[model samples]
Target: MSESSDLVMPDAADSERAAEAALRPRHLEDFVGQPVVREQLSLVLEAAISRGNVPDHVLLSGPPGLGKTTLSMIIANEVGGSLRLTSGPAIQKPGDLAAVLSSLQEGDILFIDEIHRLARTAEEMLYLAMEDFRVDVMVGKGPGATSIPLPLPPFTVVGATTRAGLLPAPLRDRFGFTGHLEYYDDDELATIVVRNAVKLGADLTQDAANEIASRSRGTPRIANRLLRRVQDWAQVKGNGKLDLSAARAALDVFEVDQRGLDRLDRAVLEAVCVRFGGGPVGLTTLAVSVGEEPETVESVAEPYLVREGFLVRTPRGRAATALTWQHLGMAPPEQSDTLFT
Candidate 1:
């Protein structure tokens, strides 16, 4: 079996950073999926622009690779403002956040990715900055310390998080708009694949695009990545064109199954179904059996599995669904119905 980390998971790699940036949609209209979010966000930005004021602080929460960062950039562009990019982990102290906040220009968009991982002190400092457009900067040391109120420009903050539930209520409640991005459907993903292929100057047929979309685990990032791989295969193995055959062969080489289950995905499913008797197994236990971290199982693998109806999370533990047994070509036990129930 391949190592879990080798799987074509949704997490971004350092090498793909430039490619992702290049593929990002410049405007909300160009964004392929999340119709409701695109419309609502358009309204919000337009309303703010009409008033000649900065938009409210926006919060975008969803799984990785769903374009939170891209939307944040779009928000900045639509508002005709500069975007300052940073992450939660980068701001280890309140001073770090204060420096960034104090440097902001009027109508600037501060995009903080992984906002849930922000340090508690930094988070508290952000509340005042977002709400009052000011930061209470402490000067001096010990008992002689004094808070100097620093007024900031009216700016918009676009916060992105994979785990929105981890955010404190104070921070969460400060955002005027919170958009939760859902995974893309196959049709939506297919559209994204075709658009990306055009940008890459690759020959991708509709059937080829559909094949890649179906095996992309319903994520545009994955769909584009798969298309790139298929393009390479087509160039070397056949004519320099991406067709259904080229896509299938390339995906097979990469160990992506018909149902889009990569090696790690299969490992998780197998561990749950075979090792744990179709499991009511705990997530940690299941992760252990598959030689992975519980976070990897939960964030990377399990979301797709559960979304595809191959797995279930019961209060007792993680369990396999009837579809899982069928996918594994196993006849469920007599008590399988009770397990699901």
Candidate 2:
């Protein structure tokens, strides 16, 4: 049996990584969903190109798998510039950041994923680089240390973060534009699944596409993953046809329910409802009850539950809504109203 962690987690496996790369949209026009963001970003890039100047710093904030990294690459493409991909965690110090910043060629787009997690010193260094296109490099050591100003070529910083709230205001304000990506609707995910099916050279029916999309938790990455799984099941168990039956059978084997709830998601709801009397329970306590890390529960499970109207996060604690009771086939207590109120 697969570990419980494998059920709903969105992390891509090694094999899936190559598939994702191949399915990625090369240009902004080919990208799926986020219409408002796409339009605004197009304007930003177009305006910059017309003026013959690098575009203003941009921040793309959204949940994982919603295509922030892809959009960053598109930004570079739209402006006809090269892209430098890095992550906040990889920059451990100011010097580390300086190396990347100083090496940027003119019109390059520096895409820093999880920008909110950047080290304080590196973040501070970025402020000057973003604003003035220069960095004060430290020379010598100790008391005799001198600062040398290094001029950087004009470039754009495209920052992507899942937690925009964690970024300091100064850092956040450095970006001239911030695009907040929301979860894709079922139709959008369906389109993404169909596109990926074509790319994978798999025969997928419309009903099967809808089935995978509806159970993808409003994520393109999950939709593609489910599509691949269904395709595999069709090849092995069926007559190599991706139809509704194949999709349903594959999802059932993977323990993904009709509403996209996996084992871990159900566990969270069960823990809150049955184990805690429908839970005005704290996140830490709830995570402990489910035998999962608090961060995992908070970041992964809770977002979808709350978005689906199955759970609510209050100042007090995490609580299951009435819909959660119905989904689990349970009756709410007589005092359940007061419990949430």
Candidate 3:
């Protein structure tokens, strides 16, 4: 495995720092997509910095790879504040959180990614730290123990979560502003591709940018990745300029269809339409039927499927839509209830 993959899934703090260092968006303008989030955050940061106080705790909720981490860094930069990275899962003990909290400077931004996974004890301590800028730290062993009252600097906590619904009500309510990041539109993703291409010093055309954007699965990171791959293809197979035809050919070779469905994406649809007769099936059943991980099916495959109207999420489970049948060159069943309704 790669060094990054073998890092034993370090605590949220280390993971957040690595993510910040590796893919931190350098400037507000360079941060791609989620324009509303940018505008809202800009207002909050400007207002807070103008008043010379840490901004209200910010809760950023979104699916993975939609720039939640990047936005957190951008907020820190905009406020001229240092960011201390951490996550919910990393905080195994209240003391772990107290150590981090006690070290923070006034007006510093503490970014907690995956905030939903925090330990219960740590979460309780954080409630006090967040609300009153103080943490009661336990000293020595149990029974004959002492609890030291430690005061923390006034710091802004920015929490990012893939599953915001899992966060407790008290924790969620503490944040003054909540920004929900949505998937990028194709145009926004195209702009993201073009921007990264310029940064990477690749020659990219408008049509090529659009083609790449269309197949980026509506994510800036994916758009950037695709751009890098296409650049490599251009270097070997054609002139270094990424023209539309070259982009299409490169993406085809990568098994990325024009509709943005990848090999695994097609596999899910194929399993449903071909194997399960266009399932109105449970997620576990579908996962087992397709021989893939259930989380992968829910996280990666289902997002695109629902976005493209090929799959529907019902109380009963996941079911293929009429669009799925049409896309797979099969007819919709007669006398069937509409999937969306």
Candidate 4:
């Protein structure tokens, strides 16, 4: 069992979001990691500035907490444009999206996070808007409906999605540039932790930063969140300094393992290794066993587990790897072919 509750999830809560906002780098140069993305984006912004025109629409695709939102905000800042934030789930209807688009000024940026989830109608409306800078707004319903074309000011759409493959080809084609962000490496994550810790007023030592980074699962958001938790521990229990000892103690208190597994992560592994006899269990069954939604299991826990070689998706279902049993401190069952079924 994990030493703490699932409420101590890696997902940023409101407070953590406030910390993230404050810690976000305003310029591309200040942003750490994703060197390839940063360089390409810099060229795009520079070319637009030289031409004295709004840059082309950008699509940023990556896993959650990889700085897509930060990049979008940076794009607006570099271009000297105001950013209007919205999400695919927010635009329930075409009118909802139209309302947002109509409000944009020349040089303004509309950042749509989770854009792959946009409704079909909203997506079609966006197709026209992106290419022609106009939308045919339907004013009436039924046979009396009228398509009144509304010309929008020239602006840029920065779409961020965790599932870029889910985007339709037509919609994907509309974007001028797509920057796929990769996970941060250990050294890069350590730098990010050290830099952000200073902004948060925590006296984090280099070794402590490295410790946090090693356990961060190559994600900056988790690194910062853990640092904040360590900061809390240091201020209250330790001598108000984030050193190696304080870092390890704080992480233990928060129930984040050395590999960055939290309560939810452990739950999935335990379900597979213990209850299901090392799995080949269906996703729904696995989710039910862990008392979490299927989406939570598939999206939140499955990715990292599979990526780290602890879980594998088989035709039969999800099976546990040898590493999973070892991670759970359980004896590996007999080498059975069924485990791979």
Candidate 5:
């Protein structure tokens, strides 16, 4: 699955990270989409800045490749706080979180990506710190352990998660403001593609930008990454012009379809339809058939497939829609008991 770099998930490679860093918007005004969240977040930051106090903890939830991390950085910038980046996996215990929290400089913003994955004990520790700016530290183990309450200066915690429902109610309730980010529309992604293309010094035409946007799977990170790929093709194969033709050729070379289905996505559909006879196949079976982790197939491939009407999820499992067969250029299978409405 990692071989399919265009699978709509954020790439963890250093090169991709460097590109994202270079192209990320530094200020709230420069953020490309999510108008409602932008407006509300701006108001919160403005009010907090005016009041000379740290803003309330912010919770941002969305799927990957959306702007949660970017928005968190914008929050830190707006609040005039240094951004401390970490992830839920990195904080394995209460002590791990304590080390991070105790080092805060009053106005610093600690951004926890994948916050929902935090250990329950660490989450319990966070509840007290977020609410009262204090943590009770244990000085010893067993019977000799002494609980020492430590007071902390006011700070902000910006927690970003792909699955908001997994967060505990106590931790979730502590966030004064929560913003849910949605996928970018084609027009918004088109604007972002064009803007980032210019930033990357590409001569991307408007139609080329639109083409990338349509195939970007409604994510700004995908749009920007595809623009970079198109730029590479333009430089190497298209006489240095990022025209519509170059963009189309590059996308075709990369095997991204008109509907943004990549090789993995199509493989999932092909397995369900051709192998399982338009399946109510279980997810593990589907992943095994397609040679992917269940998590990868579910998160990276299934969401867009389900969202775009190419696949359907049911109590039984996954089933292909009529469109999936047509997209695969195959005759529709006769309705079977496996099919669900």
Candidate 6:
């Protein structure tokens, strides 16, 4: 059996990296969608500046490519503070966190990506650092090791995570403001594409931009990537202008269908409807069957599948809906209930 025969989740770090590349908004104004978050973040920054103090810890939770890291940088810029970038996995021990916290200048911003993956010990250290600008360091050797309290510069912690549920309640409560980022709307994504095209000196027409946006999986990063690719195709195939036909041809070559089903997505449904007989199949078995990592199945494939009504999650596992069968060019099982119906 292939290694992916067992369910495996894609590496969270890898997903973060891809999302970061495609979607990290260059500025607060360019960050598309998430209106409520944008408004609230503005208020938070205003409050902090009015008082001339570091704002409360910010917790940003959302799916990948939603501009969490970009927002963190925006916050730092707005607050007139330098930002220190780190990740949960980077702070493996309390001492690692201590070093970061201790080095911060007053009113600095420390952005920790993937905060949910923080080591437990480091999480404990953060409580004190967040509440009080202090780090407790152990002094001396085994015979008389003593905890020494070290003062820290007043700084804001911007915590970004795709999995907020994994954060400890105590750590969660430490954040004074929490921002939940939502996926981009089609219009917002189109706007983002237009904005990026303007920056990149690409000739993207409105209809062409909209067409690419519609298939962007509601992600700015994907929209930007698609625009660049289509720009290349347009320059080579058509004129420099990315018109509708050029955009379509580019998407076709990229394997992103009109409905945005890539090879991985199609492979998922095919495995479900054809192999599992339209599943009520366990996740592990399905993952193993697909030769994909379970985590990838859960995070990437399942989100889109469920969103499109092609799959359903249940206590037993995942079941392919009638939509899945139809999409996969198969007839639904006679005995199965229509998941959408």
Model 2: per-residue lDDT, tens digit, 1-341?
Answer: 56866864545565667787888898989999999999999998889889999999999998999999889888888888999999999998999999898889999999999999999999989999999999999999999999999999999999999998999999999999999999999999999999999999999999999999999999988898899899889989999889999999999999999999999999999998888888789999999999999999998899999999999887889888888999999988777632444
lDDT by residue (tens digit), candidate 4, 1-341? 36464456545476667777999999999999898999999999999999999999999999999999999999999999999999999998998999999999999999999999999989999999999999998888999999999999999999999998999999999999999999999999999999999898889999999999999999988998899999999999999999999999999999999898999999999988888888789999999999999999999999999999989999988888888877888886676543543
lDDT per residue as tens, model 5, 35-154: 999999999999999999999899999889999999888888887899999999999999999999999999999999999999999999999999999999999899999999999989
- TM-scores, all models, native as reference: 0.91, 0.92, 0.88, 0.93, 0.93, 0.89
What is the per-residue lDDT of model 1 for residues 182-232, given as tens digits with 9 covering 90 to 100?
A: 999999999999998999999899999999999988788788889899999
Give model 6's clash tally.
13
**lDDT for 251 (candidate 5):** 96
Model 3 residue runs over 4 Å out of place are: 1-24, 331-341
Clashes of each: 0, 0, 0, 0, 0, 13
lDDT of each: 0.90, 0.91, 0.85, 0.92, 0.91, 0.85
lDDT of 5: 0.91
Q: Rank the candidates by lDDT, best first.
A: 4, 2, 5, 1, 6, 3
Candidate 2: which stretches are off by over 4 Å?
1-15, 335-341
- Top model number, TM-score: 5
Which candidate do you rate higher for TM-score, 2 or 4? 4
Per-residue lDDT for 137 in model 2?
95
Q: Given candidate 5, what's the lDDT at residue 290?
A: 90
